[model samples]
Target chain A: MPRLTARERREGYQREYAFQQRHGKPFFPHVVFHDTIVSLIVVALIMGLSVLWYVQFGAIPTDPMAERTGGLLGPAYEAKADPGVLGYHPQPDWYFFFLFELLRIFKTPQLLIVGTIIIPTIWMVLLIGWPFIDRNPDRRLSRRPIALAIGVMVPIVLLTLTFYGSKVPAEGGAASTEPGAAAFAAGACSTCHVLANAGTAGNVGPVLDEAKPDYATALALITNGQGAMPSFKATYTEDEISCLAGYVATWSAAVGTTPGPGAATAKDYPASCEKAGGLFAGTVSSASGP
Target chain B: MSTLLPPPKEIAMMPVDWVEERSGAISFGKFMLFRNVPKDISWLQTLGSALITVFILQATTGIILAMYYQPTPDTAWMTIQWITNEATLGWLVRGMHKWGSSVMVVLLFLHMGRTFLFGAYKYPREMTWITGAIIFILVMGMSFTGYLLVFDERAYWATIVGVNINGTAPILGPALSYVLMVGPEIGTNTLSRFYSLHMLVLPSAIGGLIFLHMLLVVRLGVTSPPWSRMEPTEGDV
Candidate 1:
């Protein structure tokens, strides 16, 4: 070959290098010097944030596993009042949401596992095995039917499941006691809210110790309104309000009188929390009856 | 086959519009170069690289701090303070790790989106795409478990949210979360659980996925130029 100008020689070198890179001649995107720098920056940043959240706002949950055994949401033990990530439950961050929402669609509260585990596993399998199944060499997005469907479906399905998960109410099974009775009162309601266990005597709520204020007087306070106490008029039906008051007034008569966190010492509040029915036992039964 | 590598230079004299592309047939220069590589790759394309950088930083800082950090509430905050106030480069390492996580999450997200929009997940490279997705998920899980290890308010609440949601899990949820987090309350067990997960489980998954993702990417070749398939708009004039 005849000698070429320096410029031509340089161009040829550059072109050759470029061609080699494209043909997979040992050129790796990740092995570059800058890649090392970039990787350092990224890994450092993520790890740093985690540590910051760890050091500054990580959570040491008062209830790590969900053992709110009794009523009253458990005693809160040693709650650390930091701005930890645990409290703000948008979810397992973004990646898991699509799957989080999936279990929710199943309906049963206990079925959340299907959302977190099974669905995600299935999704992973589908995603990983997708290439083997879809052998088309076409890169056009619109033409790759299987790929297109998967691309759309995985997120859509995952997202749908997450939306469903979000909608699910926080699971709670403490169960409202008393069919027609003010079981809360019988459930040691007087200790906290004050509705007359054995003549309610606590400042937690407007004291109901005074009386056996007949149905009408009690109705105004319990149904319409009371201090620091929102009215139950709307939340409870006329019958419920009446029955609640009577249940409160007589629970002390049947049980006794005591302050408590859950069921007011059982003795202080007649009937076990689980047995207290919600509806009225009899219309003409107690004087607090509506 | 023979290329001389020049020392790093601050080429201010050359035209500002062009990237610094030297050609002296240097040995290392040749190894570092791309032959026929697409020209469009830019700073934006370096997001994955950036993420990997931050992730490694996180791991380094985290391991160092893990040496001194205590999980108990009474000792947790104090230990952290001790690390920051007493330990060596504790503050910088911790701070970098903290900021590093945020950067990683953002870069990974950006990287994933780029992959999706560029049709980088096509036939031969689908595994790479999938591995990237798994890395994204693992990053989140790492964030989650790691947060609990920190044992702060946000972490506490986040833990509650975790537990509450986990409690919603089917069958053995209440029991499972109990076992995972080590009981119904934040105690020694909770810290241990978080610590193990943060240091071990999450990292392992992330490591494996990253390996596979990188392998596939190298094998498939960074996507080429669309313009290559067509005639050059201006042939060397």
Candidate 2:
């Protein structure tokens, strides 16, 4: 942008270049060694935190039977009303929530390409092609209005989506109060299977209301895991399980009719469950701690 | 007199000096390790070096983790649980690897921002920036593939969703999704494919491209800020 003769420009550049050459430090022991030290410190910090605090993993993969039983109950229940009564709420990691929220908002099958594929691909292309697109040699932020605006806007939008994605819906029906419902909730049987009496909306497993298995079939499946459902034989005793199977069978048989002795209390829980404390500790307050 | 017996110092250095005599390895090391950059370059410029460091951490810890990890629907979650909860200080190694990934991503974004902010991608440094951009994409691919190695419910469902998103890509979408899924559905084959990509393919590609990027950086030298006193003259160009 500045007018100058070839001779003056050459002379001016030579003087500046020599000045720069004399002022810089070597990369090896200077910058490289400093970087290495910083990296080591970071690693040390991570290791220290890991030792001091345990990284808790979520409960073992969802037990499909839970959905049929009424969905997750007791302390583990996330009380969020799923958009549909049968669809499992699929939550992606926090980092991917923006995209997940995007998919949720644009729910039409026809727009899947636009929401899931086209938009992300365009962003990736823009990121990769940025150096070429903004070729101005000026390094000042004020000189690059368009690039600066995009850099700020992208993160703002992503953060807003992530915040909204994390919020659970508060509209799911209230927790059931029946004895059979208590067992279903206590055992976390409502998370994967759909049961009308239990009021659980999960669809990871077969709908118990539709399948309408007999008491014998229900007992057998409860004792031995089927499909994605884990065997509860080890977690619950014969008396507790028998009661549960009968309760589930009664509800399944009366799916469209008045619900069977529809409510349960701590006294109704088997003595074996009494020893377990957390799920069947007699008192309703302690049975499902927040 | 010295022709009869060389000094003790010379004798002590004989092995290294002998190797250097034929190979010029010492000089090459000196050239690489002692390269100069402008003094005004601050900690902001260290992001690239930080990325390289975190990458080294990821590769090291990842290899260690892979030794005990099982890539299967039934075993992957259990094995990862074993590593974090039971294996001796496995938490430290796994935690470092996990945190290292976050650090690498952050450092990469910072490095790219710095390069752009300083206009380092202009002129002779264009190839350096291009190579860097390629490496950036490769690193992201590596991260995404590595995410599925845990094989927990989250991992399984995430892959399902991710693959479907890939499938929504117009004409090539279905084909790419099929290739990634290793079939119409995700199963053992899909895990193995992602494992191979995470453990072998992407790392090798990234390593090669980073080497090329470093080569270009060495050729043109790191660029300066717009306000820096020094500028390349016509003769220097």
- Per-prediction DockQ: 0.18, 0.29
Q: Per-residue alpha-carbon lDDT of model 2 for A1-290, expressed as tens digits?
A: 33456586456545544565566677877778777777676667556544443433334335521211112211111222211122233455555667766665554445556667778778788776777687554556677677678767876787798776665432224435434555565344665456766666544345666666666777787786432243456557676676567556656535444543422321233343344443333343345532
Residue range B13-128, candidate 1, lDDT tens digits: 34331433454435445544553334445555677767666666678888888889887766775575556445776766666665566567767757865665456675456668
List the candidate 2 regions with Cα displacement exceeding 4 Å. Answer: A1-19, A52-88, A165-290, B1-3, B231-237
lDDT of 1 by residue, A133-153 (tens): 655544566555666676667
TM-scores for candidates 1 onward, in order: 0.52, 0.68
Query: What local distance difference test score does each model get?
Result: 0.52, 0.63
**What is the DockQ (computed on Cα atoms) for candidate 2?**
0.29
The best candidate by DockQ is 2
**What are the candidates' C-alpha RMSDs?**
15.4, 11.2
Measured with C-alpha atoms, the lDDT of residue B207 in candidate 1 is: 86
Q: After superposition, how far is residue A19 of candidate 1 from its true place, in Å?
A: 5.9
Q: Kindly report the fnat of each predicted structure, to 2 decimals.
A: 0.30, 0.36
Off by over 4 Å in 1: A1-107, A110-114, A145-290, B1-36, B81-96, B153-179, B182-186, B225-237
